[model samples]
Target: MNRRYVVHVDIDAFFASVEVLLDPSLKGKPVIVGGLPHERGVASTCSYEARKYGVRSGMPLRKCFQLCPRGTFVRGNYRVYEAFSEKFFRVLHSYTPDVEEASLDEAYLDLTRCRPLYPSFTAAARDMKCRVEKEMGITVSVGAAPNKIMAKLATRMAKPAGFFEVPAGGEENFLRGLDISDLPGIGPKAQVVLRMLNVQRIGDLWGLPRPTLRSLFGMGGEEIYLQSRGIDARPIVTRSKPKSVSRETTFLQDLWDERLLLAHLAYLCDRLTLALREDHLYAHVIEVKARYSDFRTEIKRRLVVMPLQEMGKIYKIAEELFRELFASSRLALRLVGVKAAELVKSRPLALFEPYSERQERLGQALDRVRGKYGFGSILTVRERMLDSVYDFEPRRGFILKTASLTK
Candidate 1:
């Protein structure tokens, strides 16, 4: 059996760093990437300079401005971010085939089998970091340890372009002094519960009896116990396919008109299907969700016989589900969402399908045109209504804070 080692690589302030790389004038300034201060979104990421003023990822742009008034705000560009993420992953793939992309800027590589090829694990990690900096103009912090949990924790300790490694059997010593919150799966809510028990450090939690901890936290306590002992058995999964793709929007004001809802659903379906086509995958399930002004929410799903990648088919199902769900008690809605699930790794291969061969070819043609131009270049009448409801500047590609972990 292989010696089970994982290497975690994290780009430092990825979104902000890319912005700086594009415009060197913003290098040393407090750069915040998400949207303008008055916009209805949060910071996707911010520079270390912005961190000095207590700004952080997911902080509301308004609040970030309140904290760092002098910071440069950018409406984030996902195309550029995705390009950088590709470069980041390529660097990791050069070292090991078993690399798991934790997020757009974080990855875990199982270098256990390839360790013998390098002089030492640290040397391999340093080479990865230097190559990333030199080739991509981005710095990465790397951590090497026995398993994924310790590797991730080590990366946290070695942030801002640093490297650290823990030999096999030294996981406990490396993690014992760290905060309980630093452990994976330990969130703010878990921290409060642990603090009530005076378990502040990972070392402190390791001293508690498993049953007592289990009584307090149920299954999560068992997980904490194992993690405190640096026991993580999960393997690195390479190029893992996403189980589902979804798009959602929260309204600035509650909306009650069905036409407006349909328009929004149309745009959501278009975006979701575009993503599906991009991944070269199809969805066997379609789902729609809506939240009313009074806080009532409902989600409806439909199972399909054949996987689908066409926008019309997806939108039709989502719209029908939405109508069926809200037909009776349609109130002012604050949010709406569309999702594609039960994904498979290929286009529908059946002899005959819901769409004709010509229709499929047209869909592919439209996708190619949109890819060259922009999402707004080709849109249905209903999707065009999105412009009136919510300024749909397709080139601007708005993204919210989807990453919770630090890079």
Candidate 2:
């Protein structure tokens, strides 16, 4: 049988690394990108230097500052990150067209066909890292294995800036001594659950019967079993669409006013609708989530007869759901989220009805104006009201201009 090989590549401390690229002096110094000490946000990413002080991504910004007072903090620049990501992918495409982008900083490439192009898999992996670092001024680590799960695990073993290849038929040996969390899809919550059952290592996961594992993890257990033994049947999908699109906010202060909550929902719906139009997709299901002051959460959803593309229509449905399921008065809400699921490519022909055509024209016009001038050059009344809630940085213009051209 022809063995499949997967290569996982992840950029090192992506946002923090970009800061270092702009200022070489910050290379060895601890760097963090996220909110300020007084801000109600979390760290997006932190340098390894900062990690030494126990600073890590997703940790609250206030906590990070307490941990590493001397660390430099910079607000994240998504546009700059996106620009760098394009150049990064261009280099990867040179090696293989079969690439699956796991996120902004990580991807899995299928290089089985190009194995003979280089002297060895390790050499090809090294060359890939070198090309990215030399061309983009960014460092990446690579992990190679016979399948995606193993490749992902291999990358964990080869952290910071390194590369490693798991030998074919050595998947079991490669996973034997690793913690359960070393396997992909095993998150902190899953690890805690597994530990409760006295399963601490990847090897221990294999000792449990498949049926029992399934009972423990539901559908996810079968995936864990296959992955623990290095048996990933999932192919590298190049063009898989997003399962859902969502917009959410963590309130700086918990809110109770119905008018304020509605205003925020309007803003989120507009943002979500704009995203759907940009992706040329539409959603048939809308979901709303509310997290109370005590962190108690409730979700409400409704399915539409037809996929929707208009912001007004989506917002109306979301507003109705909010009113029906949530206490409208005197309820402290810590978070609000809007999600659109059951996506499909928006069909132009199907959108020829009068209402749909008008929405399509409006969206196209707005996009054209934004493309020519800029994103903030055009905005709805509701968006302007909520703009102050979002983080603002003046340097964002430079980053946006640079990324738009490259993308």
Best by lDDT: 1
Q: Put down candidate 2 lDDT per residue, 1-407, tens digits, no spaces.
A: 88877899999999999999999999899999996777877899999999999999989899999999999988878999999988888888899888877678899999888767866777787888899989988788889998777887788888988898898999899888899977654645568999998999899988888789768765356557767777754556575667689988767678777766787787678668878988988775688988888776778775443467788778877887787556543468888889998677755233222345777798889778766776657666765554544432232221212222101
Clash pairs, model 2 backbone: none
Q: Would you list the C-alpha lDDT of every candidate in the order shown?
A: 0.80, 0.77
Clashing pairs in 1: none
Q: State residue 207's C-alpha deviation in candidate 1, in Å.
A: 1.5
Cα lDDT tens digits for candidate 1, 233-336: 65565556576899988876788888878987887888888888788778866899999898767788865535678888788778878887778565888889
TM-score of each: 0.62, 0.62
